[model samples]
Target: EAMLLSLYDHACFVLGHLEWSEGMRGNHYLACIAGLSVAAAYFPACRWTAQLRRWCAEQLRIEARYQFLPDGGNFEASIAYHRFSAEMLGWATWFLNRTPEGHNILGRDREFWLLLERITTFTEQTTYRSGVAPQIGDNDSGRFVSFLPLADDAESYGTWHADPHPYLSQRNHRETCALLRAVCRNEEHILDALFDDQTQHRQACFYAHTFGVAVLRNAEAEVFLRAGSIGQRGKGGHAHNDQLSITLALDGQEVIADPGTGIYLAQPAMRNRFRSTRMHSTLALDSVEQETWCEGGGEALFWLTSDRAHARIVAATERLIIAEHTAWHLPHRRVVRLEDGTLVIEDFFAAPSEATIWFHLHPHVRADRTGEGVRLEMPQAHAILTASGGATIMLEESLYSHSYGVWTPTRAIAIQPSGTRTQVTIRWQLRS
Candidate 1:
């Protein structure tokens, strides 16, 4: 207990200096440092040992390096951080008996409490209704949990952590907030609904680049596509050179995906190399990606119409979409329609430009080149996809490996968009 108090003391001292850089700041780290400092003193324990003192002090120092943003957003770009901060602050407030002066060793716990709440509020505003957080940073589907709401000062601090944090131990930012609200209201039904074990929820998911395009979908096959840019403002880390990209779901599973941001410093070499456009399902003209490691440029744009000739749910019963975007730069207007129970992507682009288009699937999904265009085989689902027609598609072996898990390609196919204002199309179908 003494050691934890000392760590908190050290954190307060370091943060008093205010020297955190943009690359190293985040909300969760701040909350953890604050929470740990307060937790150490609030909870009873045996006499503090010298080793514990040293560890706590070191943690305080390390955490101080992470400063909070003006909007109370974390610099790391992950919504999970925001949720974690909120819970930490709530715990800190409850532990100190809601009095800042009570934890004398930690000094001002109130600042941490307020900051965590503010950050969480920002996250709540950004979260989509489907529960999937924006792919702002290093995110995978694995981070999901549901927490129930509880009333403020209605429960003991220790009991709150013991009860809620465990079940939501691995939940994402949105789940944590929902859980908090449920607990606050004392709504048993909401708590039970969120706590139901062993079920998967994937709805209103989106992956987007700044000034590029944002893609989302509900349970139905209809895709919601929004546009953004290449993150010219450097708003977040792991920004991609994919000036214009697409995000969608196929057969109720994630298919085309952003090769996510990998860890930094912990594995410095892996950063920025693999998370570029060569990994997504978007097409690149002339084998060119927007830019590499801050060396290229292009704007990601979008146009939406809730009128006729816009987002028609054709093949609705068959589970497909035919989307048409008004004319933009380049030479041709493009209409993307998925049919034949396979992802058949057709493109009509501007004047004759030598552009090489590639179809990239998630690394976990297998890919191989059959005499057909290119086929993706999912082992878990036991399905195969073949691509053919004017498109020269074939699955190629990949040189990069994923750290989260081991996966190999079944195939990849590249197509050359031909003709001036040419209308080119490729078809995909599933095989038994």
Candidate 2:
């Protein structure tokens, strides 16, 4: 009890400092209040504990309402980070519900309870049946628990002995899902309503509109599309220039994949490369980034000029997702349709301009340039890609990071318009 009280005091001292910036408010704020709340509950009788509990109650309410959209998607926009923040909130939820004395009115906080249920749903929907998560934005591989402790004082506050994979791995994600399932209960069931891989709460399609992400899954494949605001109310600290990007997995193997975050501010050049527009599977204005301000620099490694992408999904359904963005002031639209192992992507530009479309593949997936676009092959699957609209196709060497600090060589397919065009269409047909 004494140790907990001492920890609470230190937590308060740190959290009491001048409010965090807008970008930090998303995950960092919720985590702070959650820690303080948990520590305060250890000895609820003390006057100091009472004060901490009240402060945490009010602060938690604000954090939940602001950081998580009604659709349960996190505004920070990184699935890995969402799991990190959810850990803090989930424990808070369970504690408040079970510990009657320390919750400080949170037991009856209807909004708090509702948000947890929603967050849980969104997290599950975004997670693949393989238990891997999409690297939509910056993924520093943050998580709630670790068995491996930081081994060296000079390792810069990281578990040097930790496994290469963080929240991005199947094992890590499953642990998180199990934790979430324990606290999130629903009084409903429809057989096969969710992913066939699970008995309950498995959804074939999930639209987190407020967060600009739409997911579609069938027996053979899962398609995830990004079309939404850069998170943190456009401050975009963890945001990526992935507006209109696509991540597709066929039969549990990634073909067109997002380059998972490799490292953070430590490697400024690598950091910028991983988040740059070219790194995503999307069209860019001849190499120009969706967020122009993020170009050509290493400083402010955590900052981005908000709203530059101005991307959003115009329409979405289980089979189709259509979204548009104005990167470099050129209006562009991408329409993606997926069904029965076949997919079509249509890129339309309002006016002609030099541009390129890149599709990064998983390291395990071999590829070769075809007369049209490229051919993609994984363990038990093969795909043929063909492009129209007068673009030369090229297969290039690239890098893919399954988790933080580990990278593997991969192949990337690029579609470069010979000159300029108003429209381009690429089709991927998958076969066993």
Candidate 3:
């Protein structure tokens, strides 16, 4: 009894400092509040327990209402952060429900459940058939808690001895679906369909207007596109300047991927490079980034100003999806068509500009330029990329980061127009 009390006392002290120091603002802040609340729930006789419970309850309510957008997307603009927030909120709800006095502290139970449903559905819809998110922004590969056991091989996490990122093989989508299944008891069918790869591919496109994201999937291919604001309200937290960028997967294998985020604080140059427009699978005008980076301290970090882009799904069908975005004072449109095993992408720029359209290939994919275009060869897939409008097509050295703090040398196909003002159309046809 004495040892248990001592441990409880230590928890109380640490949680009290965390609550008092870091107010509930961001994802991590809310997590701290949740942890403190759970700790306080154990000491019902403590004088501060009631007040702490009320404070934590109010913080959770605020986060559910404001931190998450109406469409169920996290305002931080990072899918990985979304997962973190969802897990923290889920644990907090569960802990509070376990106590008699805290059962109704969530205020409107319906609203809370609706928020959870929206977030989970968004995650399910955004996930690729291969069971991974698009790596849209900064992916530190963070998670709030680990219910599953860690891998026996420590090196699977990363090269760094104490890497905070999750193991490379960890499937966040599968884990998230499991969490949602437990929380959303009544929505078994929705979760079942999400978990089933065959069912997910039956759906044509998942479009979220709130986040300006679109995921088009066919039986054999999937394409993820981003044409929205840089983070929430342009704060650019955990967001990349990758407006109108796309990631492609064929037959459950990544062919073209979003050059994922490298180390954040350890290497600022690499961080900036990874988030730059040139590194994404998009069109870059004279190698200039779509959004200007502002240096800030702490959570403020970096943001983009005067580069708010708006994207809309112009047309979508079972086999075709057309979307457009205006950024860097230019309007760019992308039309994707998937038929059988072939996927074709057509890019249209509104005005004349010296732009380079990049297609960053996966590390395992081999590329070579032929007379017609570039041929990309993989283990079980092949792609032929050809461009019109007299564009100069070439392959350039690039880098691909499969996880945080790790990078591999690769290649990207660059299509540059011969003149400043030209209508360039590039196509990618996949062959068996």
Candidate 4:
């Protein structure tokens, strides 16, 4: 009772003088609202507690409508961060359901419940069969809470304690799933499938137009395309210069990988390179970034400003998806199609421009150069890449980070068309 009273007192103080960031409506502020509401629910009968819970319920409803898009993607545009914010929302839902007063806030909140279900579905969709979430945008391994016994987050400027294993990685995605399965009315079996690393999925392509991501899956492989906006309403704090980038998963392994965020702030140079357009599996004109990177400090530490790309999907279907973005002062269009178990990617532009295309191999994959392209040997499959344009393929050293503050040396296939190009069609054939 005393703990409850103390929390109630603290909630009142916080409500009286709230400090919201002027920059963005991010999870940092929403988390505080969720925490204060949870505390108020513990003493629902107290007058201040009652008032605080009402305010939190209203604010959550308002922010969640904007923070999570119609398809349930967190507007930060980072998949790892979705897990963090979803956990906070799920936690608040669990406790709020327990109290009669809190019930008024949630029981009839149909829109909120639908958002939770959508968020849950998104988590299940984006995670790979390897049990890792895509390092799509910025993956700093943020977590709302760690229930594990030995989990400790590595600081941006400190020695890595996330050793021997990625305990600090929130990409496992099960924690958020577990909470939603219990409280969000999503089917338990769906969440159950994610926990076991089910290697296969239902037969159909999936696309979230609201999030601007497209997925193509077969019995043994999955293809993901990041063709979306510079999220955070163009602030780009957590977004990357990864427009038209793609990743491939085969037999539960990430064969074609996106270099996850290297340590931020501490190693600013590495951070800049990792988030650069060149580090992604996409085309960059004259080796320029898709979006100009924010360098140095403060907002530059996270923001990817000058977001004029306006990347988006032009057309999509069960078997084909096409997207384009105008960055580097040119329009680059990518067409993704799967035929006869081979993934075909075609890039098109109107005028000739010096262009470089990158396909980053997972650290575990073995890469060898061939006259036509490069051959990739992954644990689950072997694949070969070829291009229609004249290619000068070079094996370049790259880095891959699965969790915060940790990275391993990898190799990338950097393809520079023999000359400035107007069209480049790259295709990959995978063999089991």
Candidate 5:
């Protein structure tokens, strides 16, 4: 319990800082409310009155932010996150009302009602079948954040359930319903049932569909990547430019990545460019990401953290897991692990690929060229990376994700491992 409070305190501190960041744009209602919720969490343990008062003032500034977005969607286009933000804000306001400090903050009840009305209308419209919120940016965030259960007995009038939606399932529907209840706040029926109905899912795999796959870690230390032939299904809005492209997480950080969707434009050209490999942690073959976002996408998967059991044969331990499919071919399972301060990668593909594999690091990681080797400088540590084969490139970065370091591929291949059935093998080991 003490540790949890400390974590909450840290989160409140971070949120307070972020709330003050220029990038936050104070107009982000949900984010501000999330900030308020974090602040509320700290009230029990916080002792600095001046800082607490400042936090309350910041929350008050954001009270009117939600009114700016007449449409109710977040700036990021994720309905589920928006709902989660709304619920958090609602609870924050309610909590404040019950406390002496909160009484001062919750003085303006009219603002809460307006924000709730707009948010509820927006949420009800986005609820599709299978209970899965649309697989959009930052869509998977709310799954891990816990909420104090609220009573929700209101009968949903116009909920839309999209059967067999690509990213949503029956369990997803339950969450959506729970959020609906929270928005309506019909206190008689506890909405915790919806959350209780399904065992919580970990944050490793976020969304995997026909064309694109995206995964995140509970620790936010590593990112796993894999893509397949499903990009042509008109889901590029949810797709990354990664084609069999995998991202890695090290020490709770991203060393290789797709920068993720930045902005939304009604134009197709703008959206298509964001989904290209240039933005992902994959090799740029002739500077191309996918052969047309539709041509020959293949399946990919990743495993996070070190699986020591698999580290003897290879120096890498997978922290993320991925499996993907290709055309005229069987499925492939790709395991990414971090072990003994090294990263090892193994691929189990059903077919042979003449294609040379490439690993691209995030452009932000600084690399030094020293003869035939590259030394990388990461946010937390540094590493020297080299390839064993002529066609492979290995680079290591001391990841900020955990206690150890992680190495990623910049150039390599998914080849048959030394005449073995396994198609690909790569390892990142530290020298003593």
Candidate 6:
């Protein structure tokens, strides 16, 4: 029983040391509260157990109500952190339901289940047919627990090894859906509909207005677009300046891809580079970033603030999605449409502006510039990008990181319009 007592002591120590102030709010705070609940329930006889339980219960309620939106999207704006928060709350609620004192904490509450349901819905909508979540924002691949065996190297604790695609393919949507099914018991039908491939294919568009994200999917292709706030109120923490960016997949293979986040903290230059506008698949004006990163000491390090850039979905339908974002007092709009087997993107600028629209290709995809436009060749898929309005098309060297600390050389198509306003179209034709 000495081991059990030691574990209890450690739990108490963790609970005692958690900073309960406003500054300590976030995933860290929620994790500590969850640990405290587990500890209190385990050692109910402890003198501080009652008080700790009350504090944790109240904090859980408050966080559930405030940290997440009405549609269940985490206000933090990081999809990785969204999953992290959901797992924390899921564990806490699951553990609490087993204890007599905590049985009613999340009991039969419509609002509570609705929150979880919406979050799960968002995740389902964003997940690709290959079971990978689009690397929309910062993705450190953080997890609360490591159920899988780890590599022997200590430094490899946080860094993703090789390509994260295989790892993501193994656990991304399946686990999240399973957790949602377990926690929100009343929402089984919703989960079933989301997980069912037949049902998902019939649905053309999945738009989360609350998060400003839209996913267009069909039997043969999937497109993910981002036109949302720059990472929670433009603070830009864990957010890339990729407003109006798009990621494309065809025949269950990624073609145009988001350069997944590279190393963090260890290499600030690389961090800034990976999060820069040049690395993303979007338009960059005068090569200026939409948000500026501040290099400060300690926790404020790498904090970013936008230059008054904002994004909104102006129009959305099963076949088309139009989104607009304003940066530096100039509005840039992107219109994406899926017609037959062709995927078309039309970019519009309010004024004559020197801008470059980028389309970053997956490392495996081959590209050749044709007279009409560019020919993209991927496994089981092919596409041709045709630009109008006198746009100059060129290829540039780029980088793609499937995992942290590992970067691969890639290429991106840069479309520079000669006039103030121009339209470029990418016609993707899948080969059977």
**All candidates: TM-score:** 0.53, 0.84, 0.83, 0.86, 0.38, 0.86
In model 1, the runs with Cα more than 4 Å from the true position are 1-4, 17-213, 218-226, 229-232, 247-252, 263-270, 285-288, 292-348, 351-353, 370-372, 379-389, 399-411, 419-432
lDDT of 2 by residue, 16-57 (tens): 763557545777667677766676666546666666667777
lDDT string for model 6 (1-432, tens) is: 886788688886886788556642566777887777777677745556666665666677778766676766676666667777777776676666566556555564557767877776766677776555667777777665533332335333222223433333222544564555566663334334334423232257987666667878877888888887664444566678788889988876678888878878777778888888777777887757877777644444346765466788888888899998887578888899977777888887755456788889888788999989999987677888888857889999988876556778888999887765566666777776
lDDT of 1 by residue, 317-412 (tens): 232333332222343233344444433444555533556555545545655555643445542233344433454444554322222222233233
Tens digits of lDDT, candidate 3, 285-346: 77566777755444434555555456666776777777877765677787877766566677
Better of 2 and 5 by TM-score: 2
Off by over 4 Å in 3: 1-24, 40-51, 149-171, 186-202, 295-301, 351-353, 418-432
RMSD in angstroms, all models?
12.0, 6.1, 4.9, 4.8, 18.5, 4.8
lDDT of 2 at 242: 92
Scored against the true structure, residue 398 in model 4 reaches a CA lDDT of 84
Clashing residue pairs in all predictions, respectively, total 38, 4, 1, 0, 52, 1
Identify the candidate with maximal lDDT: 4
Provide the lDDT at 170 for model 3. Answer: 39
Off by over 4 Å in 6: 19-24, 38-51, 146-171, 186-202, 232-234, 296-301, 351-353
Please report the TM-score between candidate 5 and the true structure: 0.38
Candidate 1 or 3, higher lDDT?
A: 3
lDDT of 5 by residue, 1-432 (tens): 887667667766666565443333322444555555545545564556435544654465364353224444433223334555555555554444454555565455566556556555554434332233333322333432444332122222111111122222211334544554453453333445444544323344343332133444433234444543321122222334344456554553345443333333333343444444444433333343343443222321111111111111111113545444332134334555544455445555433233334444543456665554566666545665543344334433321110001112232222222211232222233222
Flag the better candidate by lDDT, 1 or 5: 5
